[model samples]
Target: MSQDPPRIVIAGAGHAGGSAAAFLRQYGWKGAIVLVGEEPNAPYQRPPLSKAWLKGEATAESLALRPARFYAQQTIELRLGTRVGALDRTARQVTLSDGAVLGYDRLILALGARPRALPLPGAELAGVKALRGIADADALQAALGPGRRLAVIGGGYIGLEVAASARALGAEAVVIEREARVLARVAGHTLSAFLAAQHWAHGVEILTDAQVAAIEGEAGAARAVLLADGRRIPCDAVLVGIGAVPNSELAEAAGLDCAGGIVVDLAARSSDPAIYAIGDCTHRPLPLYGRSGRLESVPNAIEQAKQAAADICGRPPPSPEVPWFWSDQFDLRLQMAGLAFAAHEVVVRGTPDAPGFAVFHLDAEHRVLAVEAVNAPADFMAGRLLVAKQARVPPATLRDTTQPLRGITI
Candidate 1:
């Protein structure tokens, strides 16, 4: 009698899960590969959803990470419009939403995060939306056009990107932020101020230090945002981009360790060695920062996919990647690397008002902790290397545009 081949089951077909399945094949995993997702479409790029897709510049086909035929060619089973309903750790099996029971030798949890909905009254109105999937993007895109007024409830990257896209579509945009400045939680003051100026230059109204008391609606559709200070800002639609919460309930129910997200090791392994977790769903170890945190970015997703693949294939692990992120707003291309939480001193490479500039965050030891480059690819590349190398350069040298970043090392 021939023995059955070992099967690997992947839950969630987002970037991380899709990449994991591809990497497993590349890393010589000949066993059965089943990639399951709740959505009807295959894995696709998400960054463009808030920008190009919303602006009607990109199509659904353009956002795909891989074509529909890739899975068939690779012998990987693609299960679309299906979700893993229940996980049995003891039996090493999962119950699908379609009432199918599938057993696996190993399971990969790549369940991504969902938008954090607002708690204010009238938040569930027809015109109030949050973008996390293609359906949401389509709905939000329809809400934007010439003469439309979009009131963004958060000043984060998604909200700002939508605001920029709305402006490009000849619509009016207003950003409401509770913080003292835009991008306060994720970026340094220099970059935030510069971005604010760029948005203002593009005719996007920004209101900072503002609190939303409720979302007023007319006939079950959002009509205006009411502020705690009695200010009523009328809008055609409302977009809430505050943040996201990890889809870790399934993992938590299966008795896996979960904090803000699923707690995972460097190898993306969960509490149960037979199960691994990756992407935005995992609160993974950040070796560079000497801590653990959740990183919601494409780079982070791909990195964890590689990690999980290597472990399963008995291949050598890939080197830890420097955490990085990017955003597109107006005509600006912002790229950032590393964490700036513990930085003591900040250095600027070029004038903020200039077309190209880089903001560097350094610890007390003058070690480069993070870098934010706006339309400055050279600075972003060099800063990434410096951060990975943990290089220390004098703050004055960093401020000197004449001193090449590639040559500056102390």
Candidate 2:
């Protein structure tokens, strides 16, 4: 109770909420910050929910982004398990489900996203589970055991990770995808091909172009899944990794501009300057991507929250941080710097068959657009700088294993 410095109300205590609170404190904004979340627990890392947590390789304590002491030490008030029922933009207040009305000078919505489910029949069967929150991960984990059969729906990151984890636990894992290949939408053909090989090496059964008709169960317990291809696969549990839709219903109901997600400006402020949204819940126009887009990645969450915090604290904007992301599957550590689309030309600097290699993408102007590195942090770091400076690396040397990737300079 340090005299309640400039009241701020933050909704949805996910990664964005935690990051914004931490940033505010780091920037010396000694204001009263109230982080309100519908979930009973403080903000924890959700990416692990589908990976290590599902495999029981990580625990609730380890998954926590920041400790409970973090908020306590910073004097940031956290109201957990409290749902924000209503928001009045004019009155600058939020009405909690508990019937508590809170007034704020500024508001930040970091509500994040929700997993999308299929509309087919029997979607409510006991085996049907979406991998998003902690509770969902716990339920899925409980179903994993020796000889257990897991039919993982969708061939995205979550499904593949879960499949691997289940296999490690001695469970028969089957991945059924509606697409021709796994992760066709997110990664390029090369990465997808690599991952498919890795999963195959681990003895995971993958069914591509598979359309599941229904989940068959007995006595309200999961038994098997019926596919549209007239194939039935027995299973003890089903993990749906189709995709996620941003949690923008509250903003949409409140009449905020929402396209793919709640539309925000470069500053992370919504159409209404007093209100701001960050993380997966925002379709912010990114100059780096050349247009407005919504990216569902941790890098976007952390960076956008920083921008929102700076704006709230009345500080001049910081430099636009170059976007970066990583994914871990088995022993391969994949890192990406900058954004790359199909138009970009991809050339391998190191041999693809090598234990460690880098794939560099360049534009027509010979400027580095992006780079994907496997177990190559130096290449990743250099790629980050190249994207930031829009630098050029000689085409032959970029692919030459003779020179260190960091030495790749124009």
Best model per lDDT: 1
Report each candidate's C-alpha RMSD, comma-separated, in the order given: 1.4, 2.2
Residue pairs in candidate 2 whose N, alpha carbon or C atoms collide under 3 angstroms:
349-399
Global lDDT of each candidate: 0.94, 0.83
Q: After superposition, how far is residue 318 of candidate 2 from its true place, in Å?
A: 2.2
Task: Give the Å error, residue 103, model 1.
Answer: 0.5
CA lDDT of 395 in candidate 1? Answer: 90
Clashes by residue pair, model 1: none
Write the residue-wise lDDT of candidate 1 on 92-185 in tens digits: 8999999998899889999999999899899999999999889899999888889889999999999999999999989999999999999989
Residue 386's lDDT in candidate 2: 86
TM-score to true structure, per model? 0.98, 0.95
lDDT of 1 at 303: 100
**Cα lDDT tens digits for candidate 2, 179-222:** 99998877666667777887888888889989999888998877
The stretch of ten residues in a row with the least summed lDDT in candidate 1 is: 1-10
